[model samples]
Target: MFDLSKEFESFYKNKVVLPNDKQNDLREKKNLNISRLKDGLNEYNEENKTDYKIINTIVQGSMAMHTVVQNDSNDYDIDVAIIFEKENLNDKGPLAVRNIVTNALKRKCENFKKEPEVKTNCVRIEYQDGYHVDFAIYRRYKKENESEYTYEHAGSEWTLRDPKAINNWFKDEIKDKGQCLRKVIRFSKMFCKSRDYWVNMPGGLIQTVLCDEKIQNSYERIDEIFYHTMVEVKNRLDNDINVYNPTDTSLSLLSTKDHEKKVENFKNKLNDKLKKLDVLFESDCDKSKAKNAWYEFFNHDYWKEDTSNEKVQKYSSCYRNTEEFIEDLVNINEQYYVTVSCNVEANGFRLQPIKKLLRSLPKGWLPHGFSIKFNVEDTNVPKPYNIWWKVRNVGEIAQKRDMIRGQIEKHVGNCKQEHSDFFGNHYVECYIIKDNVCVAIDHIDVPIE
Candidate 1:
């Protein structure tokens, strides 16, 4: 496929994936909205002489699933579930409950140019800067005093729903299926949302369901997997546009005529793009042509744009004196999927996962000098496999210090311990060999600040 792996990784990292700064901003905005909602509800209760109170609030949807992509319009959406005790509401209809939440938002969030409005299923508060929050109201009541509480969402009628069901479903898929699926879903979303012309396109949840249903996992690079997965999903959609909820098969996510129209449009467009990628399978296809094909598919220049001078300089500095290639030292077979994760420890105290710490900090980096223990967290390969570890360090500090370690070594256990000695985008890769053939592989990059 012309090996556009580097290009795809760069595009996904720089364009499709939301930056850490944007993620932090979204989290702050969501937190502010929640605070306002709760405070407004309190004000509503005091002014109306009512006892309405919020029992629970949960962030759901794409934000909760961590599949949110960078959009051109900056139109980020946050879905939250606002739950209350049914007895507190005294038997209110769906619209009535929505109205209460809308009024509460109106009372506290007066800065919005567009006021909080009650939708059929949620109360939406739109910010002037293009961010919106959807609060899905739900009520819980005990059928019998001794029985557990039953949850019902305030839809047209009170419909049974577990607010966390969809999120849990995606989590389970990631846990069992593979992490690559999450990246595929994000890339598909980026493609579907690349241009604003397709206004009727399926939303993130629907798109996620589609990807889950027709995902194509492979040992090939992520770019290839995404291309084939999009084709598979389009074929599936052509067969049927009805997308059932992953949490509940009985409920269809595409319940409206507009949703069906959106899926049809998406399927047709994807078909057209997949036809453009036919050049990829040709023997004469080269890197430039393959990337251009991807550009055509995504309708984005990220695929076609030349590497920036800054990136070139960064790469030159990192690799100017590097002589080791991990692949040259070991046989690499990606047949069985494996995932590696690490724990950051300081002063004998295990703090948190390295990736989690990096996401919480700026620039996807961690403090130097922390001890790291990388573990083979998940794998589908059978037991009795040989494990190999490689720690590669890059950056001016590492290069000047004469510590650019890139050796592949056999490890004694599933966990490999190392310390952050200097600044660099250091990474640890684990290779699993079964019967002298590398069966699975995974790597986790740890950027030292």
Candidate 2:
């Protein structure tokens, strides 16, 4: 491909990434608004004789991940997680809690052009400028005999969500690789949000996940790496549009109808744009053609200028060979999905659901003699299919004790029972095989602390 590494880098700095000055200004604005919220709530408490207290605040979304890009419309969305004690809510439902927070935000802010509105999941305050702040209200409480606190968001219902899970996942990714992946994510976001006509593009978190999965950094030039990575992402989406959350595999990021449509739109548009860039890899491609291709792709004016006269190198895409897992060996035709749930018991006394314990307990620890029973709750697949289960244990203790059991076994029924003997990040996967092809599959994590 024509070497546009210099051009890509320049465009990234001048157009794609947010400027340092703007970043600083946004930070100041965010801090000021947060302070106003806290003060307003305090005043509300004093007058109403209520004891609502702010336990913690967390910054999430693209801003926390540092993958924010410049927008043509100058519209910015800032997310802040506001945590409160469970007693403060007094058993109020989701909408009531949101209204309480919205009333608090509307108390004494002079700069607000409009009053704060209560959405389904958050309280939104819009400024005179294009910036809007969303305060996601959550309640925290410690379970009995557990050291860690459980956080649940006041959405349509009380939904369990770890406020720092996705942020920590992205931070770990950056630590393992480097800033190059962040840059690639920014470039991908710029392309996704380039045109005004394109509606319902995938949001920053989904884009970040896609880039993290498909990024190829072996190439020296940034342009070449981005091109190949985007192509790989497009190809993957062509088969399956479902995107599972990395931290919690059971949670689907595209759970809603709107989000599913958004990803479908992104996949189609990305395929069309990547086809135009195929000319760059031709034998007789030059700088002018390459510049036009990228300029049209990003729809940016900075890409119009050409500052390099470097020779074009023959583009040979290099892809890393990932180890094939057992699931990859099968012809996965996921026409349906199976729901897996676990039952927990200690000394013949039943406890809560294992899924709930997994969220509340920090390390997914169970008592010494606890037994677990995994049941296939629901499935739409036809009858007479083979049921297979696999238990994989992973941890330092499991490795040191030589107890890392990871074998697939065939079972006769829908329920499988096992005892928790060691502490590790163990998991069980269930697969439904029909006519020598996997028709449905599901897995549940069993972390032992």
Top candidate (lDDT)? 1
lDDT per residue (tens digit) for residues 58-117 in model 1: 778787777789963678998889999998999988899899888888988877868999
Residue 43 alpha-carbon offset, candidate 1, angstroms: 1.3
Query: Candidate 1, residue 129: CA error in Å?
Result: 1.0
lDDT of 2: 0.76
Clashing pairs in 1: none
Give the C-alpha miss distance for residue 421 in model 1, angstroms: 15
| Residue-level error in angstroms, candidate 2, position 207 | 0.9
Each prediction's TM-score versus the true structure: 0.71, 0.67
Report residue 74 deviation for candidate 1 (angstroms). Answer: 1.2
TM-score of 1: 0.71
